[model samples]
Target chain A: MNILYTKNISKSYGDFWALKDINIEVPKQSIFGLLGPNGAGKTTLIRIITQIIFADTGKVHFDGREINEEDVRKMGYLPEERGLYKKMKVGEHLIYLARLKGLSRNDALTKIKYWLNKFQITDWTDKKIEDLSKGMQQKIQFIATIIHDPSLIILDEPFSGFDPINVNIIKDEILKLKNKGATIIFSTHRMESVEELCDHIALINKSNVILYGSKQDIKQNHRSNTYTVDYIGEFRNTNGQFQITDQSETEEGYIRSNIRITNDQSPNELLSILIDEVEVHAFQEKIPTMNDIFISKVNEGTNA
Target chain B: MHNIFLIIQREYITRVRKKSFLIMSIVGPLLIASLWVVPIWLSTRETDQKTIEILDDSGFFKDEFIETSSLKFEYIQTDLVEAKTEVLSSENYGLLYIPRINLDEPEGITFFSGKNPSIEVIQDLEWAMKSVVEDIKLERSSIDQATLDSLKADIDIDMINMTESGEKAGSAGVATIIGYISALMIYFFIFVYGIQILRGVIEEKSSRIVEVIVSSVKPFHLMMGKILGVGAVGLTQYIIWLVLSIMITTGISSYFNIDRKDSLPVQTEQSGVIEEEQENEFVAEMFNSLESIDFSLLAFAFLLYFIGAYLLYGSLFAAIGSAVDNDADAQQFQLPVTIPLIFSLIVLTAILREPDGNLAFWLSMIPLFSPVIMMMRIPFGVPYWEIGLSLTLLIAGFVFTTWIASRIYRIGILMHGSKVNYRILGKWLFMKN
Candidate 1:
């Protein structure tokens, strides 16, 4: 079941189209990655869903109905250019945000206490936001994003200012939130995190969605029928059974080579040919990494 | 609506809790109270009486010189040289040497002193000598003092304003003062409170908190909340000032056993008992004129115009704040918004000069100028329909400016590091959200 989706979303700023004919669905209780390069209209699309800005022509459906101000309350948004009132205390700022998102004062206080204790920063609650360091502020912002217990949480560049340890903590929290049944839209240029956590992703390029689907399905579709083989010595007589796509030497004197199977040849046949030619150590299919797929797709867009 | 309230609460609480706000609240009443009490207090304190020694060679002015509280005249029998030495040696202020001359054309009446004598002293001495010569001349023409005194007429014209409710006693001086003061208060409040709105908007935009705010609530709500919040701060300060000022003034006045009705002439009596009678008459006339004014209507109009003008200008200031990244960038936009306000101030004297004139009518009809100009006319007894029409236009103007400002504000807050100009602001006004 889809928790939120956009249909035929298009937006323009004068002559420049920021988004065009965009469509995506965020499934229930799953991590969704919204990947795009700088100025590729990702923020614009996020704003539309948050109702900060209007789309020239589009409809955003949350749960079973069209998105409204009420629905916006059920969704939490942490913008990329996020900030808190410097003069306000951490507890006050969080409570203000939670109340703005439709939580009662008591509920906001309880949730804030719970989150602060969970993050082990309960002592920092009374301190001003300006007094906190950047990493601390990032954690506070992260807590603010979900303090209202929103069903759909959108975090833009959520890990930008966090250290590795905090990033792992946040990643764990995100996974835990998902496990407890919340749909997450994680928008960022970082592909490694998308690979690690995102169950689904939509890659936008130049105001268009260039690639989108389940992570497994996309990785499957981009596969070029290639496999890597690690061997001790190079016996290059394949008898045209496969084509050598790339070859390199490992630091441990292992010949690491990649080969694409020829017409209708399965992995078993390729492995049989490789064993006969050299002392085979390891063999594996070469599935493309998200980073590689992103670069290539973006490059193709630029070239086109 | 709830989000707007939260925004307002935050804005108001943050500002009211500030050190500056506390300082201003305490200082504002003292300043206003001093403005009222200081002049009266100073006037009541006795000034040093300067004694002038007169060496009248004509011998016709010996009895004419009279002593007043601030100026005393002493007739000396010595010659001019001796008088000068005696005046310099003594603690007298100056020596007045009156040379005997023909009564038809008096000339060269020199007064010697250590420094330049005040014009009041010189005029006082001259009037004394001239009156003596005039009495002598009248005697020479066979006219008695009683006849001359009876022939002199002192005419006082009581201005009676003819209105639909019959003739009403009015004083132009009192109206001018009231009109000018109310107009100035309106002008002062708009600038002080309007800039607060601007700075608030700039702070949010520069700190990048506006996006997080807009995501939860509408930009319109945020702008209005800020404007109303700052306005509430202004109103609170004004009320505290009013209460404190009244308390201080009453406390001081009662402690000194001073009655407001008798205070002015009593202070003037110490300077010159001769002017005391005239001062009392003028004070009484001013009090009568105050009675003729409808304070309730004036206050209602003031409240209406104050809020209308503030809302009108406050939104514009907010828009300017949103459009710029900092106070430095706001100068260009601020100029146009402030021009009308400054223009009203420049023409305030002219408006008061002829409160019901064509210039006043047209300027007060324009919403930008009406808050100040109409206020100036209100104390002078404006026609009810004219006031109503101006107020309606002002309300309409506020609505229109707020609409334009919100349009620009919603877009401007999100646009950072872009050099904004009037043309770009114009574009943003029409840009879709």
Candidate 2:
């Protein structure tokens, strides 16, 4: 089921459209990547979903119902412009934010202790946010965002200030949250992470959604019908049926060529033809990475 | 409602626990107590007697200077040069030379002191010289000295306020002091605590925590929570100061018996019995002057105006805070908010001068200035209808400002990095989103 979706949502600042005719669906128990370049209204769409801002011309639904104030209690948002009260104690700040999301004092305290231990930050509970390093503060901010056990979590650039190890830790946590049936909307400029994590994604550019779908489907739709073949042969080209984009001979006397076939050819047909000509060691279709798709689609948008 | 309360709790607890708040609460009363007690104590303290060397080159002025407990006159038969040398060599506190001159003119008298003489010494010297010169003039004109001496009585004016009902003694001096002080205190708290609301909002915005909190609670709630929280803190500090100052003032005042000698002037060469009688009457008048004010009504009006004025200004301050990116940016908006506060303060002197004048009446009726201007006018017996109207307007002002502020607040807190001019803020106020 679609846990959250925006129907024709649009937002504008004076004459500048921050988000325009944006529609997205976040499936339940899925890690949905919200991919966009800078100034692409990714943050604006996330804000609208979290209700930090109201969409100028559409409706946002949570669990197939129109979003309301109570939906905020069930939703969590970690904004890209992160902040905590620098003068406030780490534990107090967390508990306060937790209680604000409708947890009782005791519940907030108990949850705070659990998260502190999970982050290995129990010792830093009494320290102020200013005293913590940037990575540690980001961890605390993450805990603050999700401390109330929100079912729908939205993180905007959550990995910005984290170290590689801490990034893995947070990625593990995001996966763990998905396993526990939480719907997550992850927004970032890091396309490689999106390729590894997102089951679905929507690419937005210039306040408009240029591409969106399940990860596999989007890659397939943008596929160029190209394949790389690794074979040992005294090579001869196929005459006008397939196009060799690149050819290189390995040091072990093996020839590797990237070939794109015409519309009439299939991978199996090329594989059978290659087998008859040379001993084919390996052959695979080259699926485009999210990084390539994001760049190409964004460039396509800017050009158009 | 609950979220607003929680926010208030957070704001209040953090501020009240600050070391600066504790220090100010304790040190403020001590400062106020010292301000009132020190001058009274200094006047009553005993000082070493100082003798003045007087050379009467005008022989007619011999034995003219009187000896008081703190100052002594020692007549010397010496030339002016010798007297000056003696004074320089510490023979006396200073030298007073009455040079040879016609009593009618008396132009050549000189007082030489190493440092600036105290005001008391100067006044005494002038008094003695004037009395002596006048007596001599009267004697030369063939008037009886005894009659002139008896006619040297001081004139006292007992001012009365004549109402339609009867004549009642006026307490202008005491009323002015009370009125001016209360007006200034209201102005001070509103300015101080109003900025606190501004700074608190700026802190939340600059730190970027506003979005996090805004997600949980409406921005209106957050603004109201902060404004009320800071106002409560201000009220707490004010009450503590009030109670402490009163305790310290009364404690020190009675211990020093400051009321007695400070109120009565020293009567020169009067009979002991008559001086004692006049001192008692003066102390009685002081008590009567204090009792003339309606303390309960003054306190009630003071608190009502204090809260009204603070809430009104506090909301505007919060709006300015949300509109700006930082404290420096707040300066552009601050001037407009503070103009009314400062204007009321500038008009305070005029209110004290004429509490019943049309300027005071109209200014006191204005909601922005009423908190202070009306406070000053209250001590001078303002009409009840004016006070009621002023309060009604103040309440309406607070409500209207809160509405306007919250409208801006709802949008401004989430906005980042935009240069916010007054026009932008005006648009935000009316913006539906």
Model 1 misplaced regions, further than 4 Å: A229-263, A267-283, B51-58, B73-123, B133-144, B254-274
| Model 1 Cα lDDT, one tens digit per residue, B1-433 | 9988998899889999999998998888888878877776765573578888888787777667777766787877876777788888888999887788778988778888888889877887777677788889998999998999899898989988777877778988888888888899899999999999999899999888888888789999999999999998898888888898899988887776666644563432223564767776777888888977779999999999999999999999999999999999999999999999999999988987788899999998999999999888888899999999999999999999999999999999999999998889889988999
> Tens digit of lDDT per residue, candidate 2, span B1-433?
8898889998898899889899999899999988878777776673466788888887876766766656788888977887788789884788888878976577978888877788778777887788778778888888897888787887867756564546656688878889889889998898888889999999999888997787788888899999988888887888898899999999989997766556345554424465567778667666676666667879999989988998899999999999889999999889988999899888877877788999998897788889989888887777778889999999999999999999999888988899999789888887766
Q: Which residue pairs in candidate 1 collide?
A: none
TM-score of the candidate numbered 1? 0.91
The chain A TM-scores for the candidates, taken one by one, are 0.94, 0.91
Chain B, candidate 1: TM? 0.89
In model 2, the runs with Cα more than 4 Å from the true position are A229-240, A243-258, A268-282, B53-64, B74-102, B105-122, B145-168, B250-260, B263-286
Taking the true A–B contacts (Cα pairs closer than 8 Å), what share appears in each candidate?
A: 0.83, 0.65
Cα miss at A270, model 2 (Å)? 3.9
